[model samples]
Target: MIQLYYAPGNANLAPHMLLEELGVPHELILVDRDNHVHRGAAYRKLNPNGLIPVLIDGDLVLYETAAICLHLADTHPEAGLVPPLGSAERAHCYKWLMHLTNTVQAEMITYFYPERMVDDAAAGAQVKAHAEARLAQMFDLIDAELAGGGPYLLGAQFSVVDPYLFMLARWSRMMVRPARNRPALGQYLERMAARPAVVRAFAAEGIAAPFC
Candidate 1:
């Protein structure tokens, strides 16, 4: 059986949601962040960065949230989590996935954990405010994409990208500029929250309702 080491609501949530979407049998190995289990030597051996998620499948050990989502989608193509390889839609998948992981999510990290970036406690508020402003613009770009063709990022069809997108959107639920504050993003997120996979993932991850 595949094993996914995870901490609830972390980047691991994306893969957790996808696994639910794929309807695969996998083990959830919770890495206790409160107790520093993820930071321990054993966990570090599994992931040098001491990340919350480390996917163990047969002989392959995968880290990185987007990489894991891609792997699960590729391994089970019948689930149709991604567009067909070499297709135009497939190219867009790659584009948005990279943008999510490298750009949007990176900005989210700064928004939530400004202490990591700023030295002074007072500066942390400024850092977080700046990140929230940047995220508003970034999410607005996504809303623009939706305005053209949406309900999902790929429009009509739900892709693996949605899980990562949903995860990031959920992160902003408590932000000063929460996703639900925007009309397009609010409707899009509500739809995602109602998905069976997302519902199941929330239950498994022990995340309570008002999931979006």
Candidate 2:
């Protein structure tokens, strides 16, 4: 069976939800992140970047959350977590997934770990504040897109991008202007949170309510 290395509420969330959505037999391996196990040599062998998520399938060891999501979607095409390849919908799916991981997730990293980007404690605070502001703009644009064409990012189809978006939005739950405050985006999150697959994933990870 497939095994997913994870820490609760970490980047592994999107893939975990996808696994549940796919109804595939999989094993969840806790990484003990709070004890810094992810930074250890063994974990580094699995993912040199020491990231929270790593997927092991047979002999393949995959890291990178977006890549894992795409792989799962591709391998389980019947589930339609992604659109048909070479189609416009598939292209759009790629677009949104890229935007979520490359753009939004990067900014979130800065917001949560500003010290990595700056020299002093004061500078870290400034970096975090600026990152939060940028995240707001990013989410605002997403909200506008949802306002025009949602129920899902691709409009009616529940794609891999939706779970990725939900995971990122949940990271902002403590912000002054959280992602849930936006009208369309807030509704989108509620819909995602209500999904049986999403609920199962959260429960398996021991994540409680106020999910977004």
Candidate 3:
């Protein structure tokens, strides 16, 4: 069985939701971030970086949300979390997955939790403003992508991309001005929030429903 060491209300929720969606049997091990449980010797032995969402599959251990999602999808093709390699759709999947991790996830982390990257408040604010502007632009791009669509990032079929987007969209609400003004984004958030897997993930963390 796969063992996932993670913290609720963090980026780890993305892969946790994916596992739930795939109906894959796994153990959810909650880590206490506030108390620095991840920094302890036991966890560092698993992941030197001491990050949450450390997936242990027998002798193999994985970190990083995007990597974990891709690994799980590839391992369990029937789950349909990702498109198979060489397929045209797979190209889009890889593209957006990278964008979500490097672009969307990067800016949000800088803006919402600047202390993680820097200590000076003035410097943090400047960095956060830059991130916020970039996030607004990205949200617009995502909105345009869905303008002609019904649901999901890549149109009809859902995949691993959904959970990543859902996690970022949830974080957007924490921004000074929420992205709710963007109609497509708002609709997409609604769709993802309605998913049973997403709901269960939030519940497991003892968090209130998405977007309050």
Candidate 4:
């Protein structure tokens, strides 16, 4: 059985969703952020970064949201969460996955924790403003991607990449202009919300519906 240590609505949401989609039996270990358990030595042993998510599958241990998502999808090819190996769609999956993590999610992290990016705490607000602007532009690109044709990111087929996208866009809820405010992204988000996978995951996470 796979076990995932997570805090509600954290970066772990992507993997949690994928796990539900895969219909694989899994255990959720709460890293109790409200009590700072994630920073505790036990959790740190699993992830030195003190991140909210740490996936443990027998002898294998993994952190980082995108890596976990890709692993789950690729390993469960029968679920069609990821495109076939060496195919054009597979290439597109990798491309968008990287961009979602390194670009969009990165900006949101910086946007939320600007003090980490600046020498002085006073500059944090400016850093946050700049990051939010970048996020707006990023969401615009995501909207464009959806507009470029299909219902899903990589055209007609839905992949694990969609949940990753949905989770990030969900984080955008606090933004001045969230992804749901964008036409294409709004419709896309609606579609994702309707999925049984999403419903189960959100319920498990204890997050109330009307999800972003």
Candidate 5:
């Protein structure tokens, strides 16, 4: 069985949701980030960076949300969380996944928790403004993508992309300029939030409903 060390209401929610979606047998260990549980010596042994969403599967241990999501998808191809290699759609999935992790996720971190990235309040505010603008643009792009009548990111078929996109969309609400204006994106969020896997993830973490 796999063991996932995570915290509620954090980026770790992405992998937690993915694990739930996959129906994988795993142990969920709650780490108290506020209390510095991740910073402890023992916890650091698992992940020197002190990040949440650390997955321990037998002798293998992994960190980073994107890497964890992809690993689970690859390990369980029957779950259909990812597309197979060499397919056009697979390329598209990889493209968006990278974009979400490198672009949208990074911008969100800067805007949502500027203190972690910079010390100057004025500089932080400026950077946050830029991030907010980029977020708005990204939300518009997502809305357009889903506007093609998607019950999921890649149309009718759901994959790990949905969970990853859902996580980023949820983070958008925390931004200074929320994505509430995008009706399609807003409705998409509602659908993802209603998924049983997502519900269980929030409940497990003792967090309120994400869409609520």
Candidate 6:
């Protein structure tokens, strides 16, 4: 059975949603993050980076959230969570996934953990503010894409990118200019929030309302 090491509302949410959407049997191993278990040697053995999520599938141990999402979608191609390989849609899927992780998620890390980059609390506040501003622009671009694309990121097809985007967008709920504040993105979030698979994932993660 697949075992996923996770913390509630962590990056693991994307893969968790995909797993629920696929209706696959898997084990959820809650990481004791509050006690710094993720930083301990046992957890580090699974993920040297000590990230919140580490998916163990047979002999394969995966850490990165996007990679885990892609792996699940690829393994369960019948789910249609990813586009046909080598197609333009697949390329776009890769593009959005990359942009979400490398760009949006990276900026979010800065926004949430600015103290890691700055020496002073004041400087950390500035870093977080700037990151939030950049995240707003990124979400605006995504909102425009949805405005033109009609529903999902891949033009009406619900792919791995949707849940991934939802997980990231949920992090912005407390921001000054949240991703949900935009008309198109707000509607998009509501649609995602209504998904049965998404609901199950959120519930499993013990995530409360205001999910956007």
Arranged by lDDT with the best first, the candidates are: 2, 6, 4, 1, 3, 5
Question: Mind giving the per-residue lDDT tens digits that candidate 2 earns over 52-161?
Answer: 89999999999999999999998998988888879999899989999999999999999999999977878999999999999999999999999999899999999989
For candidate 6, what is the total of clashing residue pairs?
0
Give the per-residue lDDT digits (tens) of candidate 4, residues 79-139: 8988888999899999999999999988998998999998999999999999999999999
Q: Over the stretch 120-211, how does candidate 6's per-residue lDDT look in tens digits?
A: 87899899889999999999999999999859989988999999999999999899888999999999999999999889888888887768
- Which residue pairs overlap in candidate 4's backbone? none
lDDT of each: 0.91, 0.96, 0.85, 0.92, 0.84, 0.92
Better of 3 and 6 by TM-score: 6
User: Per-residue CA lDDT of candidate 1, range 171-203, in tens?
Assistant: 988877787778888889999999998999889
- The runs of at least 3 residues in candidate 1 whose Cα sits more than 4 Å from the true structure, single-residue gaps closed, are none
lDDT score of model 2? Answer: 0.96
**Residue 198 error, candidate 5, Å:** 1.1
What are the C-alpha RMSDs, in order, of all predicted structures?
Answer: 1.0, 0.7, 1.7, 0.9, 1.7, 0.9
What TM-score would each prediction reach against the true structure? Answer: 0.97, 0.98, 0.93, 0.98, 0.92, 0.98
Off by over 4 Å in 3: 115-120
Error of 2 at 184 (Å): 0.3
Count of clashes in candidate 2: 0
- The per-residue C-alpha lDDT of model 6 at residue 210 equals 68
User: How well does candidate 4 match the true structure in TM-score terms?
Assistant: 0.98
Winner by lDDT between candidate 5 and candidate 2: 2
Clash count of each predicted structure: 0, 0, 0, 0, 0, 0
